[model samples]
Target: MLIKSSKQVSRWRTPKRFPVSRNSGASPASRIEPGVSWPEPEGATRVQRFKVYRHDPESGKNPRIDTYAIDRDKCGPMLLDALIKIKNEIDPTLTFRRSCREGVCGSCAMNIDGTNWLACIRSLDEISEPSTVYPLNNMDVIKDLVGDQTHVLAQYQSITPWLRSKTPAPAGHERLQSPEERKRLDGDYECILCFCCTAGCPSHWWNGDRFLGPAILLQAHRWLVDSRDEATGERLDELEDPFKLYRCHTILNCTRTCPKGLNPGKKIAEIKLMIQQRRS
Candidate 1:
């Protein structure tokens, strides 16, 4: 090659080869042992300690943190697994609620690493070290991780989530709903009632008594958008109250925190339109 200018000689050169794998180029499956962690040389430690919050109401004591150590390499990185190890081996008295162990049951809802999440679905790797778990904020704490959901249940009942059509269906026939109508309620109907949206709403903090919040509004959308329902006008009337509809500040917290990817804000907008159109 011919010699180049000074500027060309000063140019940086990129590396031609990447670093080799540390594990002798072995595939991950070949190295991994089922039900047992891969060897980590001699005297390797794989324990992670979590700073879990604890509170007892009957004793009238303050909330506190209790450290729990769990073997990270043995089980998956799910927070629920850590909790189970803590409960079984570390502290049997530690209190928390979980069911189904899947994301379907909302019983494991709590603040993990300062955000409301279902412990069953939240991986330990996503959380910061020394993670803090607490009962959901703005709700009554029944114990350590359990919340008194009587208020959320009351609001759910206030909106009347079930169908209430003025016309009853014939005994032998079903209420026919077209595919178009079914598609209308798709996004709004997937709510798992995890209460993450409700806990994040500022309107809930101020006027939970009158404002139904996003969960109820989404449930209302499920009914109002259904073509088979004859009580759309009546449901609109109930939602016409300013506090019930306008109290939502469009903060978008409900949509952001929804575990099932439902948009409560969008459903509330539809409710607003139904109320306005019916009045006119």
Candidate 2:
């Protein structure tokens, strides 16, 4: 929704003022600051390679990896910094999902060095040369580095993550619970829904549709254990299917891949235990 007037577009196309840096002869187009040039003479000293996955589903073609050589010194410490730099300086066609520039948004989840991580949180200095990045594994690619999250999101929606009950709340009163009851939400609510846990799980890769997967199951457990939620039995009943609850084979990938350190395996195990206790 860029509603730029014709005048503004013309002005941008033909800038009256061409600010030039005293050092690098950089024009306004590549100015890093008011008068500083991007890739400052001393800034870009070494080369860092990036192998990014590229594919647009709109075009009928096989996906391929594209390599970019970046000036290591020109990039900021984080991996997202290097990506943004590459997009700005080398190739605008390169694309990936990013927002908030912080880990909380959960929008920038992708593989770095063959492991899932939010690019904003992984420091560029920590990784070696020829860093490889890709979208979450085995998912539909809408474009370069962007996966179609429609299916995973739809699965998340199926769980009814919010509290629901046939009973009505008292008028003008809030549902209250003890601090201990609130503690149960700690690990589960902390999940950013980045899909790292589910995407990394071999079991989920095989039984995704039937299993509900770790990310979905983790949030399901969150609502199921809420003190004010009266639908515990209903939630448990829904998750009792063998395929949905038992597909997890404990390869520990879910626990291993979580950037937030959440153990979806543990959460799924609790769900199973809860169901077992109910039956007994």
Candidate 3:
């Protein structure tokens, strides 16, 4: 898709500092991996306090943290599990969106203690201090932990997330390609569209209402790489606008915040390369 030029450029590209690495230059605790499970904190039988942000839009009330106390032992599970236990046993009004607790649905993405994570995937033991949970940054919060997904859904719709073809199929089975061809969009096809990338993005923070963020760019690139996609030119044209593609300054927030390890920054870069190669 071509981005229209009438859109204004944003100054969200300013640099900022990140926290120091805690594991001798290794990845952070919030990193996601299959078959990895988090244990309880080192030593604590006492109560654990959780500070979760609350939002009630109907009353025009400002968002604030509401505290909850749970037995530290039972809370050692995944944060999602703990939150569910707390709500079922303590307060039902504590609100958040989640499904497919196995981390596939991408509904549980949130800012936990200043980082984005799918609560079902993050172990409570990994959090070192009293923690705070909030909706993803820079999005309209619909409730305590649910941000408005309208922009995100619109971007997905913009890409037409399914396969499209302009030619009629042959008289046999569909066209086939080598394994290598299928791998062209390997990691990108796994995207769950959780908005973690956009949430971490400073550009999205400033231009979310206008620009299509990394997540959208990644999806665009995914289709661009698909061997079966028929409208590559049309897709590239849609992204030509300033807010649609050029807004990305390679800040890498989308890469860092993704719970599924999908690199939207890398995808955008690849899309740029494809665009350049097509021009050449």
The candidate that achieves the highest TM-score relative to the unseen native structure = 2
Worst 10 residues of 1 by lDDT: 5-14
> What local lDDT does model 3 show for residue 262?
75
Give the number of the best model, judged by lDDT: 2
Better of 1 and 2 by lDDT: 2
- TM per prediction: 0.79, 0.82, 0.81
**Candidate 1: regions farther than 4 A off:** 1-44
Encode model 2's per-residue lDDT on 142-168: one tens digit a residue.
887888889889989888888887778
Put the candidates in TM-score order, highest first: 2, 3, 1
The true-versus-predicted C-alpha distance at residue 273 of model 1, in Å, is: 2.2
**Residue pairs with clashing backbones, model 1:** none
CA lDDT, every prediction?
A: 0.72, 0.77, 0.75
Model 3 scores worst on lDDT over the 10 consecutive residues at 2-11
Q: Which residue pairs show backbone clashes in model 3? A: 1-235, 1-237, 1-238, 1-239, 2-237, 2-238, 2-239, 3-238, 3-241
lDDT of 2 at 250: 76
Error of 1 at 237 (Å): 1.5
